[model samples]
Target: MDRKKNISMAVIKRIPKYYRYLKELAENDVDRISSNELSEKIGFTASQIRQDLNCFGDFGQQGYGYNVKELLAQISSILGLDKEYNTIIIGAGNIGQAIANYTYFQRMSFDLKAIFDINPKLIGLRIRDVSIEDIDNLESFIKNNEVDIAIICVPKERAQGVCDIITSSGIKAIWNFAPVDLKVPNDVIVENVHLSESLMTLSYLLNESKITE
Candidate 1:
């Protein structure tokens, strides 16, 4: 999706949270909801929600607020959740296996097509019903399959090389779990998930409070 120059990255990041909140509202049988109510529940200002959705065109009515199900459907379309993605996982380590087992990914339209690893023992082993293939056939496998995304769970040492291989193998996007930063072409999107950094930040926040106390 070509990002509009008008919308900031911060607003884009908040879309998922809004989607989650809307899903919760739907679960509670909410038919319609006001921006004020959303603001209180979502922790974002009503105007901010208005501003973000306005960028995609008018979704909310003046008096009616917004239809909960319709609004969620709109948000899902905006975030490309409506599109089906054929994804593969690189590396069959703990992180890779866990990601492969995440049913949430499939529910979100990211269907795992296969898992690849260099380890001989892991190769041909099935995790969550998807068999891990040899890394040697990774490129060729992508070439034949309708692979849209690659989940990188390899070690930092292998990440860059894997990035280059996958990006060149016709994958559209990368969800990198490796700690090392990866470089890719302008066309390929990369989302680096640094678990340890996030954990350390949480640790620091907790320790800072303890130290002050």
Candidate 2:
């Protein structure tokens, strides 16, 4: 989809936010929301919201504004939430366990197929009904199973090595939680979640807000 490729990453990032807010609205029994109302809730201009949504296709009608549930479903499909993606988490540490235990991932269509770790104590253990496999069997498991994604929750020192192994095993996408930037081939896609960097940005914003006030 050349249209998808041409879309700005900022706009792409906002799609999840839109889905989340629409979910919240759905929960609150909001059946419909005008662009102006949506702007108030999401803090983006009505024009901007329309522009973002229009990038895909026209879903809004002249008089109906937007159907809340239908629009949510549309955004869900656009974000690839309509199909289930089987994923394996590569670490069983604190962060990894939290992700493993989170049922939200399942709701978002990311099925936790398995977990992998090098620690002898963790291997064969179960987290949220998914068994932890030894890292040694990772490649075999991946080959035998329909694994769509790999999550790297290892430490910085171990992150690159784990990433290399997983990528070499034919994994196309990786969600890396480790605090390191990984080098991957052109065919591989890596989304690094740098919690510290995000927190630092928040800190800077808070300080700036206080100064402005």
Candidate 3:
């Protein structure tokens, strides 16, 4: 399917939810489902689901709905899950270690090649058989290896410095876990996962609900 240019981020974000639900349906041996049925399960209105999917291409039939496995495969391809990404985490601290231990990323084709840290104690320590290397080796490692994405799990203070090292070493994509955002060249893409901000959002929602109650 030919992807249309300038798809809105809101629609892009919802695509993953579609993929997840479709994957679950596929796993359960579901053959086909109407958009309304999918809407009930995913909490999106049927019209909204159809519009979001139409951003990519025509999907599902008027009467028959979508073929579960086929739709899952299509969404997977759209999300680039079909390709493998060699990823490295800079900062073998708690967040870093947890990410390294998550095998689901590997199943999604994000291979954790190495982990880097400034701490000498963490260096040489292995998480899931991938040894944590010294921060000093980071540049050379990226230079020698085909590292596609750099995962920044370092402190906010050091996040930019590590990002600079990664970008200067010719890496274009970053999965930043640091609270602070990193400035990058126009060609580079940074996806930030700020844990504290997410927690704060949940806290705000919880308090808002309590006030309403």
Q: Pick by TM-score: which candidate is best?
A: 3
Report per-prediction Cα RMSD to one decimal: 1.9, 2.0, 1.0
lDDT of 1 at 188: 89
Give the candidate order by descending lDDT: 3, 1, 2
Mark the 10 consecutive residues where model 3 has the least summed lDDT: 53-62
Off by over 4 Å in 1: 1-6
TM-score order of candidates, top first: 3, 1, 2
Error of 2 at 143 (Å): 1.4
Tell me how candidate 3 scores on lDDT: 0.93
Q: Candidate 1, overall lDDT? A: 0.91
Tens digit per residue, CA lDDT, model 2, 1-213: 223448888999998888989999999999998888899999999999999988877777776788899999888888888899999999899899999999988878899999999999999999978999999999898888888999999889999998888888889999999999999989999998999999999999999999999
Clashes of each: 0, 0, 0
Q: Which structure is stronger by TM-score: 1 or 2?
A: 1
Return the lDDT, model 1, position 34.
Answer: 93
Q: Name every residue pair that clashes in candidate 1.
A: none
Q: Name the runs in model 3 displaced over 4 angstroms.
A: none
Point out the higher-scoring one by lDDT: 2 or 3.
3
